[model samples]
Structures are given as C-alpha cells and as structure tokens.
Target: MYAQPQPQTTGRYIDLFPYIPWLLTGGMVFALIFGALWERTMVSTNLLVNPDTAAELKPIQLKKEPIGALRIDVNASISYNQWVTYEIQVKDQQGKVLASGIKQAWAESGTWVEEGESGTWAENDLMGGLDVRANQSEPVIIAIDVLEYSDTAGKEIDKPVSFQVIVKNGVVDDRYLWTGLFGTLLLSVLALFTVSSTGKVVINKSNPDSDVVARAICGNKDRLIRVVVKVQSDEYSPSSLHIRLTVNDANGEQLYSQTHLVNVKRSKSDGKVTSGSSALTTFFVLEPRGSYGFHAEVTPDASVDRTRIIVRENARTLFPVKVVTLKSSDAQ
Candidate 1:
C-alpha cells in the first residue's frame, strides 16, 4: 500500500509572527533616541523681572527649518506659597507680535495627618513651553511681562523674580513618539497570546492503562511535540509520583527518554478537600518526517486511581526554545 504525503505546514511563519511587534518596539526606541540627539539648543539665558516691569531680551536670529519648527521653554523661580502670572511674546524686528500667550507658576508646602499617620508634603510646579514655526529666517525678540504676583492666600507681593528661558531647534514632539511606543508595547504583549499557534491532540485518554502507547505523524521537522501526563488520586495517595516518558522512531529505535517526579496537591473547593492530582510535561522535536511512537509508564501504579495522557503535535510555546543536540539524546 502506498503511503499518503503529509500536508504542508506554515508552522515556521506562525512562530515568527510574534516577533514583529517587538521589532516595531525596537524601531521606536531607536527613533526616540535619535530624535533626542538631533535637537540643538539655540538660546539659553536668564531674565530678571520686577513686580511691574517687562524684561526684553536682545534680538535672536532664527533659521527656519524645511520640515519642523522650534520650541521655547520658560521656567520661573518663586518663593514658597507664592504665584506669578506672566505674558510671553515673540515679535519681529518691526515690533509686530507674531505669537503671544499668558502663563503662571506657583509653589506650596504643608503637613497632613491621615489614618493616624503624619507627614509633611510639598508641591511646586513652574514651567511652560511654546512651539514656533517661523515662516522665514529673520531676527526676533522675546518679551516677558509680569502681570500679577501674589501669595496663595490672595495677598499681593512686591518682589523681583528670576526666569530661565530656552529655545531649541529640531524639537521633536514626544507626544506622538510616546503614544506610538505605548501602542507598540501593547501589541507586543498581545502577540504573545494571539499569534501563538496551537497543536493538534494526538491522544487524550482518561484512566489510561499503566503502560500506554500511541503513534503520531510529524508534518514539519522544525516543530515541537508535547507530552502531558496527569495522575489523579485521593487524600490517601502518596505525596509524589514518578513518571517515565519515551519516544521511538518508526523503526522501534528509541530517540528520547526522561523521568520526572510530580508533586501531588489536594484540590480544595468551598474550603473542603477534594481529589488530588499531579501532572508532568515534556517537549521534544522530531527531525525526521515520519511516524513516531510515544510510551508512558508510572511507578507505584497503586498510588494513582486514574491517569490521563495527552500527546500534541506542532506545539508552539509562549517563548522561543533553544534546541541543543547531543550525541545520545534528542529532547530538551
């Protein structure tokens, strides 16, 4: 009788699908690093401001980019529990206001006791930024006008404050980068579960005999096979069970053999003791495209009241396996 050919398998491609998201994540990391390095500081200076005076800085020459724009950042230093509101403006050499906005900064501190635990707390936030896309290369001026200065209790304060101003070229909008990275990471996590392929069950028998045997065919030489054995008993059973698993080629030549000691745990339901069960699992790859035999046996068979043997072909695990070959073994 002529033997039928096995079906073509796409197991290799399926196994590689899970890594695509990780590759995207790596690319995102590279882009983020490159963007941070590409940015250059165009201006860094400090301005002193009185309660009712506007600080005007020297003219700054800015070059317009063909693709992206520049960024302006301002930070204020104020006393505790005090707040300052200021107006920022970017003007052309002719004193025309091209862009303008109002911003505020404040700092506060206090102590609190909650749930019998006491601690001191302090919070201070002081920074603002703006994006500018120059239509053409020109000289411009940056002006800061302090509008109001007061304490948190609505008391006016008369004082001089220092402000740090910064202008940067090639500024990258990290909002999109961060959003893309977050989405890619989520996809990578989901791929671990959705992209993995499941195997076909070759044998699923309950209450199997002490020495059970089954035969299965290997469609792909690169795919893995899994063997799972479950033993069930009662409270009187022993604490552990010893199991032996063996795989043989079509010619009755042993290819793999291993022994495992599985610890039995009594299952509980509604705070009551139930049946006890223990399981043993092993994985191996069959390189030859042909039929193979699986054998399983349990020691001290009297300790197990029921048994189950599950053999699966083309098994895909959550993580990649590193296969190592030895002169006398073919399992890992």
Candidate 2:
C-alpha cells in the first residue's frame, strides 16, 4: 500500500504573472514624475511688452540631443471685463519665423441669483500658451506683438495694456506619457482576466443527483485541485444548505473529506421574487499522477432542485488560500 504525501505547507508561493500589469503601471508613474523634474531644470526668461510695442527676448541656446522645447506664457494687467490678445513668434538668429501663434487673456466678474440663492462670482481665464519643439541647438529669438486690447462690450480701450511674457526651454511634452499610462492601465485590467486563469475544468455536471461521483486523471503530481458545488433554489427553499465532499485514491481508500455550508438568498426583480444560487468550494492537492474519485452530497435534496458540480485540476487563485491537513478519521 502506497501512502499519499501531505500537501506542501511551508514557504509562500507567489504567482508573478498577475502582477505584471501593476509593475508596468508603476513604471509609467515614475516616467511622468521624472519628466516633471527634468522640466524644472531647464532655463527660463521673462520679458515685458507695452501697448503698440513689440518685445524681443535675448537669444536662447537649446540642447541638441533629445531635442528641446520652447514654451511661451503671457500675462496681462487689465481693468475688470477687459481682454487683451497677443501675437507670439519664434524666430531664428537670422530673423526667419520658425513658429507663430496667438494668445488671449481676460478677466470678468458678475452676480448670479438662482433658486432663491444670490451670490457674486468672479471668473477669469487665460488662453495664453505657445509650445513648440526646437530641433536645432542654434540660438533663437522670441518676439511678442500686442494685437488687440478691448472691453467685454467690444469697445476698444485707449489705455495701454502692459503684458509680461515667460519663455522656457527643454520643456518635456507630457501628452504621450499620459496616453501611455492610460493604455497601460486599460491593458492591466484586461490581463487580470486573461492571464490569471490557471485552472482547467475536468468535470461539469448540471442537476446532478445526491452523492454525485466522478473520476479525473491528472498528468502532473502535487498539483492543486478544486471542487465547486452550486445550488439554485427558489425563494421557498431553506436559507442554508450543507454539502459534503470526499476524495479517494485509486485503491478505493479515502484520502480527504470536508463539509461546506452554502447560504441562499432571495432577490427581487421587476417586483417579483427570484431564485438565488450560492456556491461552495473545497481545495486539495493530489500528490500522485493517477486517477482519483470525487464524491459530493448535498442535504435537503428536495429544496435544491437545481445543482451543479465542477471538478478542476491545476487550480490556482489570484489570492492564496489556506490548505488544512486532514487525519484519517476526518473522512466520513
């Protein structure tokens, strides 16, 4: 008579496949943070412009490798409800226009009353940014031209509008990084369902009789096996169900046995009570590469009109489960 070996209960076993997506997520986060820090280390300059006057900033030298970027930010001092627009251009040392754009700044405030609530709210927005990539290391000049100054009523203002411009180099573009992070997160969610399945169903029977019996052959030794029993009952069935699972070796000798309790709950849909089903699972390890017999029995057989039994081999879960050792007397 050959005795079966006990299941391994020592060190932990971690499956790294499920965690690969999280690892990729971490990498994208690191990249976004690193890009922000690198942007702060670049050179920045500020210039002032008055009405009807153009401001030309000093020549700026850019890095050749990795290519450099230029960012222009404009700020204006105006009266309430006033708006100002500026034309911005990036030119080479020879005065050739490399890039050009327009930006606007405005400020406004008003009162609102809705649903017996009255409050004063002030809102302002600025659409004043120009970003361009610098392909050459040669010095370039930034030029700013005041295009228009007016009030919210479309009336031209005679007063001069002072403007401040900020120019920065080596600014990293975060659009691609954000896109990559989003794509990686989506794929990670999808991988959880596709890559984490390690179990294969050996037997699946519906509406099985009490004391259901099945045989399964395992090609691998010391692999985990899972038994699942599901019961579907109407609202009139009992609240709880008891189940018994037994495993035996080729010689008809019992190896393990355990009892499970499944609770049944009733659900309401479209103003009608519906049947509810619950499942109970038991796990064990088969040590020898051979065929084994499984037996399952459910109590209150009349209450459980619908029953399903499943036997799975090489079963693995996303999380670890505790496997308890059973003595010879535990079998019934």
Candidate 3:
C-alpha cells in the first residue's frame, strides 16, 4: 500500500513582542549594576576624614576587601608653599565626634603620604620612599591617632581642637591598625563557608580503606613525614576470601606493608580458623621522617577492605590558635 504525504505549516516570526519584557529586564539589570558600583566607589562610607595624606584605619577588614577608606592623594590639588590647613573631622554615622587626632608632618608638595599603625604620618622617602619618574616625589604620608574623650561619658570631644597645622617631613605614615583580632574568626568561618559553597577543594584519588582527610597536628614543616594506606573496593569481600593491598609515597617509594589472610573456616565436623588481630585494627607509626605508602591483601582477616595510615609529626603537638582578648578576659 502507498502512504500519502502530509502537509507542513511554515512557522512565522511572532515571538518578538513576547521578548520585549526580557530585553527591558536585561537593560534594567545592567543599569542597576553600574549604578551600584558608582555609588560604592564615589560615596565614602568612612566617617573619618584625612585632609592631609593619611591612611584611615579601622579594625580588621571583615572580608578580603577593605571597608574603611579615606581620601589619600585626592583628585583636587591643595595650594602649597603656604600653610594650607586641612581639617580631619572624626565623627560617627550620626555626626558625633567618636574620637579625634592628627597625622601631622611635612612633605614635598605632592609626595607619597604614609600612616603608621597609630595613624602617624611620615615621609616614605626616609623609610624607603620612592623616587618616581621625572625625579618627582609621589605624595606625602600623614600621621594620625585616635584621642578618646574622657569627659562626655568617656567620649572624645572636638572642643579646644588645634588650630595650626604642624608639618614635619620624614615620619613613618603607617596605617592605623586595629589588631586585637575580633572579627578575624568570623571572617575565617565565612571563608570556610565560601569554600564549601563553591566546592573548589579537590580530593585527590586515593584508596578508600584509609582516612582521606585526617586531622593531624604537626609542630613544624621541617623534618616531617606522613604515610597513608588505603584498602580498595569491597565488592568481592562477601563471596571471596582474601585480597591484596599496596601503598606508596609521593616518589612511589614503598615503605611498610605485609600480606594478611582472611575467611579460612569450616563447619559440620569441620575445623574453623580465626585470627585475633583484625586487619582493620592494624595501623602504622614511624619516627622522625620517612618515605611512604603500602597495600594490604588478606585472607581470613577482618575487613582488610579497611586500611590504616601512619602519620608522624615533629615530635610535638603545640599548634597556634588565636583567641580574642575580651574585656571579660582582661578583668579575670
């Protein structure tokens, strides 16, 4: 029998109007991104002002990116050769003077400005300052510090503030560092969360019988050796007797291993055999340093599918752990 062919309808371009919403959505998203970046870059979130070249300081930068930033080498040029005074008004978000201090110093018209840990300014030319191209100094560093208020319920007041601008060159402009380390722990936890969320950590292929990611304490990186033994798959363990295992090191050098037996028994007037030491209980321990790895095959052994690894340290277990110096701890 002959089959008749069917007719096909040509499709028309009718979906353009439907995609207008998506186009508008995409444009809005693009504009929003640029606007957010512009706002973040232009508007300074810091409440501290650094008129002279100074590095504004804050506590530990929560994320890898810094949060507190002040104007250093600002775009507008200040008229030099005369006493051009600049004001560093310190206040909180509500415009209250949290604390105030100065990073006083003298420098070339437009040299690099550096602030010390206490916000003190100094010329980098003295402490390894640079001689930029065209034989011109980059900018002058500013010195600064925080002055706590002892009267206003233990608050620093800006009253009786200094009027003259004291300029001195060649002072170290170190960043005002808040190094008590409170939020670093929070940052670390966030970092771990990011890592786990991103799953960038790759677990190298190894035997399943040993602990792949074991927690170990090493005193130092120098003179330390570690060995891991892994038992392969256990698919054949149920019906079969014994299996073979091997271990190796970074250089594929074999260190310690032995063949084991398993599942040798009988019943109904038959003699059964049993070993007291199970291969699962077998582990290794080496001293000082060694080159390693091994395989274990066993017959009549308990769970040779399980492997043991020997880890060694620098004969010490003192690992450094940072803790917060809380006010409560201080009182105690």
Please tell me which predicted candidate would have the highest TM-score against the true structure.
2
lDDT of 3: 0.30
List the candidates' TM-scores in order: 0.66, 0.71, 0.18
Worst 10 residues of 3 by lDDT: 323-332
C-alpha displacement of 35 in model 3, angstroms? 37
- Give the whole-model CA lDDT for all candidates, comma-separated: 0.74, 0.69, 0.30
lDDT by residue for model 2 (1-332), tens: 44544544422323556678778888999988887776633334455566577678777765454733667776666777988887888888898888888877788988899999999887776547787775556777878777788889989876655656676656667798899899889888876775324578887777645457777775244466667877776765667778887777666778766677878776768956577666787666665566777777778776566777787777665566655333333222
Candidate 2 Cα deviation (angstroms), residue 298: 5.4
Query: Model 2 misses residue 23 by how many Å?
Result: 1.5
Which pairs of residues collide in model 1?
none
User: Which segments of candidate 3 are over 4 A away from where they belong?
Assistant: 1-183, 186-222, 230-293, 296-332
1-332, model 1: which lDDT tens digit per residue?
22222223333433666788899999998889888888888889998988777787788876787745678889988988989998788888888788888888889888999999999888988887787888789988887778899999989888888999898888888888889999999999988876333678877776645556777766345656667888887655667778887767777777666677888888777965566788876666566556777777877777567777787777776554433121222322
Looking at model 2, the pairs that clash are none
- Candidate 1 regions off by >4 Å? 1-14, 51-53, 66-68, 114-119, 192-241, 246-332
Looking at model 2, residue 274 earns an lDDT score of: 70
Best by lDDT: 1
Candidate 1 Cα RMSD after full superposition onto the native fold (Å)? 7.5
